[model samples]
Target: MLNSRFDMKDMDLAHVILGIKISRTSNRLTLDQSHYVDKILEKFSNDDTSLARTPIDTSKHLLKNRGEAVSQVEYSRVIESLMYLMSCTRPEIAFVVNKVCQFMQKPLNSHWKKKKRILGYLNGTVNYGLHFTPTHLYNLTWLVTRMRTGHLIVMMRRSTTGIACFWVQILSLGNQRNKRYTVSRSSTEAEYRSVASLVAEITWIRGLLQEIHVHSSKPPIIWCDNSSTVRLTSNPVLHARTKHIELDLYFVREKVQQKN
Candidate 1:
C-alpha cells in the first residue's frame, strides 16, 4: 500500500510476506502467519513434538509455576510476535499463543518446548487460509442459482501485538462444505455441533458478513447435509435425546426462524 501513494521505496512484497497464508473470496480475504511459527519450531524445538488433535486440549491443565527461572527476554519477544498474529487473523493460534505468552515474565525450558510444538503445527498447514467466496459457500448443495457475487474485502491489523482482527467490509464486489454421517439425532443437534465447535472462535466471519448487509429482512442461507437437523430447527418437537443438547446451539435456528 505504500508505493502507490507517492514514494515510500517500493520494497518488494516478499519482505512483508512472512510465510503466512492468504485465502480469498470474490468478496473477502483472510491472512494467517502460522508458517513463521513453524520456522520458530525448526529453530527451537524438537522434531518429535506430539501433534495436538485440537487447538486447545481441554483435558490438559496448566498449573502456575514458581520453579527455577529462565531468561525472559527471548521468551518475551517470541511471545509478543505470536500475540500479534493471535490478535489479528490467526485466532486459531490464540490458545497456544496465550499459553506461551503467559510464561514470558519467568519462562522455563519446559514452557519454551511447548511453544516449539506450536511451531511444528505451523510447519504442516502453512497455507491453510479459509477462502470464503460466495461461490465457495454451499451449506447444502441444493441452492446454487440463488448465489450471487458479494462485495467484501478482509483488511487485517498488523500492530505486531494487540488483537489481530479481520476488518471485513461488505460493500456490494461480488455478485458472489459437505458432511456425511449416519446419525439418528435431532437435526439441530447434528448440524449445530457439526460446525466443529463454537468455543474456539470469539466471533465468526458470518456474523461480520451479516453486520454489513444492507437489509436485515432475510436470514443467511444455511445448507445442511442432515435434513433431520433442518427439520429440528424449522419445527422444534424435542425428544429425549435432543433435550440433552445445549440450548445455545439454537441461536442459528432462532435467528433463521425470525427470518433474520
Candidate 2:
C-alpha cells in the first residue's frame, strides 16, 4: 500500500514553541518559558544583582525623564521583549510592564533600573507558569466572579475598577479600568461602577461560551463584599444620588432579570 512506502517517527510530546514551554499530563497542562526568561535575564541583567521580592515597588514613584537619558533604544527593546512574555504567560506583570513602558521615548536611569527590577523578578519566577486542571465534565454549576475598587494613588481623584472571571476555578479572563469614564462621587459609587463592569464582563463570557456550544443549566453568580452595591442591583429604584450612574444600573438590572 502507499502507506507502507513512507516512514514516520513520533516525537511523543511538544516541549517548546515560540518561546513557550508546554508540559502536559493526564489531568493538567502547564505552559512556561523559564528558558526564555533566563535568556532575557542573561541578555539584560548585570552579574551583580539581588532578586526583588516584587516585580514593582509601590512605594517608589516614577516621573518623566527630567534627568539625563540612558540608552532609550535599549530600554525600549527590553520593554518590548518583556511585553511579549507578559502577553503570553505572565499576566501578573501587566501593571509593572504598563508602568515602565510609558517612558519609552526617553527613559531615565530610574526607569531603566525599574525595568531591570522586573527582569530580576522574572529571574526569580522563571519556572512559574499557568497551570490548568480539568474541571468536572458535563457540570455547568461552576462560575466565579470577583470585584475590587481603589482610588488611583498617582492620579489623585481618579478611581479604578478590577474584575476577574473564573470557570471551574481556572482564571478565564480579567480586567482593570481606570474610571476616567466618569468621576465617582464616593467609594460606594466606585464600587458600584466596578460591579457594573463585572456584570458586563460576565455577560460577554456567557455569550462566548454559548457560541462555543457550552450551555449552563443555571445562571452565574457574582459575589461582592459591598452590601450597598448588592442592594443597588436589586432595588430597581434610581434615587437622585445614583442618577450619575443610572445607565450602569439599567444594564446590571436587565442582566440580573435574565438570570445572568
Candidate 3:
C-alpha cells in the first residue's frame, strides 16, 4: 500500500523504462532498446555505416594510442552512450565496450573506427534483446570467458529454465577490466583470475538472496573451459609458479571446499 502513504496515480503499463522497451507475451518477456540504438547511430553520424555481424573486429589488436588523439571529444561521447546501452540490455557487447573504454582518454582514429564498428553491429541486431520465460528450477551457473590477451574477464549467469529445457543466460554479473597493474603470464592464470572474480560475485549474490529469503535447491556451479584452471581449483599442491596468485588460489579453494 504505497498508495496509502503517498499520492500516486497508476500508469497503466510500462512500455518503456529508462529507455528500455519492454515487450511481453503469455509466458515470455523481452527487453530491448532499438530506439536508443538508432538514436546513438544517428547522433554519431553512423546511420549509414555498413552493417557488421560482430561487435568488434578480433583480427585487429586494440592498443593504447601513443600518437596524437583523434576526435577525442566525439570518441568519449560515443563511448558514454555505448556504456549505458551495454549496461541496460546489451550485455553481449560488454567486452567491446570495455575494450574501447581503455582509450577514452586519448582515443586514436583506430579507436574511433572500433566504436563505429560496434554501432554497425548494433544496426544489424537492433531487434535483439534479452528474453525470459517460465522456469521451474532456480539453478544458477556462472560462466567465465578469458580474453586472448589475458586482460579481460567476462562472467555471466545462466539459469536452467523449463520453457526451452536448455540453459539460458538470465543475468550478466560481471564484465570487469583488469584491476591488477600486471597482466597474467599464462592463459591458466588468466582463467583462474576470472574464476576468482566470478566466485566473489557468486558469494555476494548468494548472500543477497539469503537476505531476501530465497534459497537455491543446491550450491551454484562455476563453469570454465580451461582444463588447467579447473584442475588447479581442487588441487591441494601449490607450485612456485603459482606463488604470485596465492591469495586467489586460497580464496577459491576455500569456497570449493565448502561446496559453495
Point to the candidate with the largest TM-score: 3
Residues 90-129, model 3: lDDT tens digits: 8778777877887777788777778878988988898887
Each model's lDDT: 0.46, 0.73, 0.75
lDDT of candidate model 3 versus the reference: 0.75
Give the true-structure RMSD of model 1.
Answer: 13.1
Q: Can you write out model 1's per-residue Cα lDDT over 65-181, one digit (the tens) per residue?
A: 634666788778767766765554455676456556655667877676666666556656555443443433312111111101111100111111112222222212111111222
Worst 10 residues of 1 by lDDT: 145-154
**Model 1 regions lying over 4 Å from their true place:** 1-30, 42-52, 55-57, 135-260
Which candidate leads the pack in lDDT?
3
Error of 3 at 209 (Å): 1.4
- Write out the backbone clash pairs for model 2: none
Note each model's CA RMSD in angstroms. 13.1, 5.0, 5.9
lDDT of candidate 2 over 1-260, digit per residue (tens): 44478786667688898989999999999988888898898898887556987998877777773567899889988999898887777877876786677678878887888887898798789998878897553222322222222232234455545454455665445533233456667766777777777777777777888897887666877776677878888887888899888998999888888786
